[model samples]
Target: MTAPQPNTAATAKARLFGPGGLRDEYTQLATRGRQSDSESREWSGLSVGHRMAMLLLAGVDGDLADLATRDWRELPGPEREAIKSEVRAAKVAFSRLVSLSGRW
Candidate 1:
């Protein structure tokens, strides 16, 4: 059998940003936001907390695979809720931003 070939888009995305998965894309966006200041551009990016929330949303395949993962619960109730909201909102906002920017 031959070795598997990686999806170039996914590979490039993961290398420059994250773990190279759809869910991972959320986290990558956060990092990209930090590295750049363009609000319109960075909306797609996320903070570390945002990444964790998105991973959680993605279910079993989510990034928070390990039980040893940090205590998201320990955060203040408001903070936790806010992060969750941000993750959910991000899916819509990011896509709209990307579409409008036409940079893709």
Candidate 2:
């Protein structure tokens, strides 16, 4: 029997937020200078915007981190629009979380 061919095309989420993507980039920045596995666990618990804020505080490029919450223009129209909507909700949630925290 012949083996099935691998699907080489990256999925929308993988292309936008998986390895080597903007989310990974920000995660790398946020976790920089850390020295323990427990810290990794803690970092994993953080939301996307919190990770972005950590990256900002670490003096990394804010533009790169901001890309996570933006649409992936490289994707075709429908997929792009879908991902954009999802990211928009994430941005709104993050903003509300930050705003609520500030009031505490």
Candidate 3:
């Protein structure tokens, strides 16, 4: 039998930016010493679409997942809210594309 295929998206992302590339953010989140399961999973989900967006934008730091952080809140409340809204909207759009891919 063929070996089970891996999550290639996650694998490719790891190669491009090392495993758990957001070490700094994760570290800060786990300042108490270790991360809980929920924190780890949350970071993984949040990074997916954000990573894809960075790849599409061809940002100079596109290959660096550690670039993500909670610093968005440092902005004024209105601007921070606007940025969060855009990110959520973009994530929804990307999910639609994922749902439509293949099966044609």
Candidate 4:
């Protein structure tokens, strides 16, 4: 008698950085002090490019945040290739990652 579960993509997004989730928690904290400052505040220790890589990975049904959580030890080749292809085709951009990551 198990309840139904959301698909992997939905569950992953909901868990990874959704509201009240860990990533959102830090992102919220970092942006809290930037209102009166001229310079934009930085996000959780993750670099913009690395963060971009995560979102790109997410978009393609890959688990980059998982990799990051695991410190990028080793991810599968096809998954990595798919993400790279998406980036190269200009189907998406790194800024999209930041934008989506901030979206909630």
Candidate 5:
């Protein structure tokens, strides 16, 4: 059976980036981590850094890292420009949402 998550994703994610009850969330994670033979004792805090670090440690950085470092000029001109434009638009859209309050 799946172990209980101390907080739901929405609540935990909110708590992580700001001040709330993420201490208890991480406490529960540590307990489950120990029970599952995972890292439990090394928790510092449940910040975005921790979340990103854990994602990177789990190899989530592989493809995205590769893509980020890729030379756009290596592709055919039309496709390269198209991709650059797409990425630029995506970046703009993402940035626009950064300052809004409450969930999307």
Candidate 6:
């Protein structure tokens, strides 16, 4: 039998969580948020907090999509609830981060 193929999504996630990855994205987002103004025409009028929150939500959705691709059976019950919890926590944390950056 051929060797099993690596999960590309997992590999991508590893890179995203590695040094100079998601952290760097966060830094850029914060910097841009701080520099944003009411007159700035970008992102269709979405605030920095809104943008960050959407980014956070996209990450969570990616995680769930990866899980689904691996095995849909793993998403039921506690696993699903855990993802929900993560979404809630991320929303709060992202909001706090944006607010702390004085962009809120």
Question: Which candidate comes out best when scored by lDDT?
Answer: 2
| Candidate 5 structure, TM-score to reference | 0.25
lDDT of 5 by residue, 1-104 (tens): 99887668787676764432565457558787342222222222334454344334333434443433333222235543454455456567768775574575
Clashes of 2: 0
Give lDDT per model, in order: 0.50, 0.53, 0.51, 0.51, 0.45, 0.51
For model 2, give the 10-residue run with minimal summed lDDT: 67-76
Give the per-residue lDDT digits (tens) of candidate 4, residues 1-104. Answer: 99887698878887765545666556558887332222112223557566566456546454545544432213345654654565466554655566566856
* Superposed model 2: Cα runs more than 4 Å off: 1-36, 66-104
In model 4, which runs have C-alpha deviations exceeding 4 angstroms? 1-58, 62-64, 70-73, 91-104
lDDT of 2 by residue, 1-104 (tens): 99976665656568655646776566557878342255344545667786565444434443745543442332245543454455566677777675567856
lDDT for 65 in candidate 1 is: 31
lDDT of 4 at 15: 76
Indicate the TM-score of model 2. 0.28
Q: Write the per-residue lDDT of candidate 1 for residues 16-84, one digit (tens) a residue.
A: 543244544555487863433343233335455555555565342423534214344323356446555
Expressed as tens digits, the lDDT of each residue in 6-85 for candidate 6 is 99999888667554567546755988744233222333355446544544554544543344333212234555455456
Report the alpha-carbon TM-score of model 4 versus the true structure: 0.28
RMSD for each of the candidates: 15.0, 13.6, 17.5, 14.9, 19.9, 14.8
For candidate 6, the TM-score is 0.27
Tell how far residue 36 is off in model 5, in angstroms: 48
Per-residue error (Å), model 4, residue 56 = 4.2
Best TM-score goes to which candidate?
3
lDDT of 4: 0.51
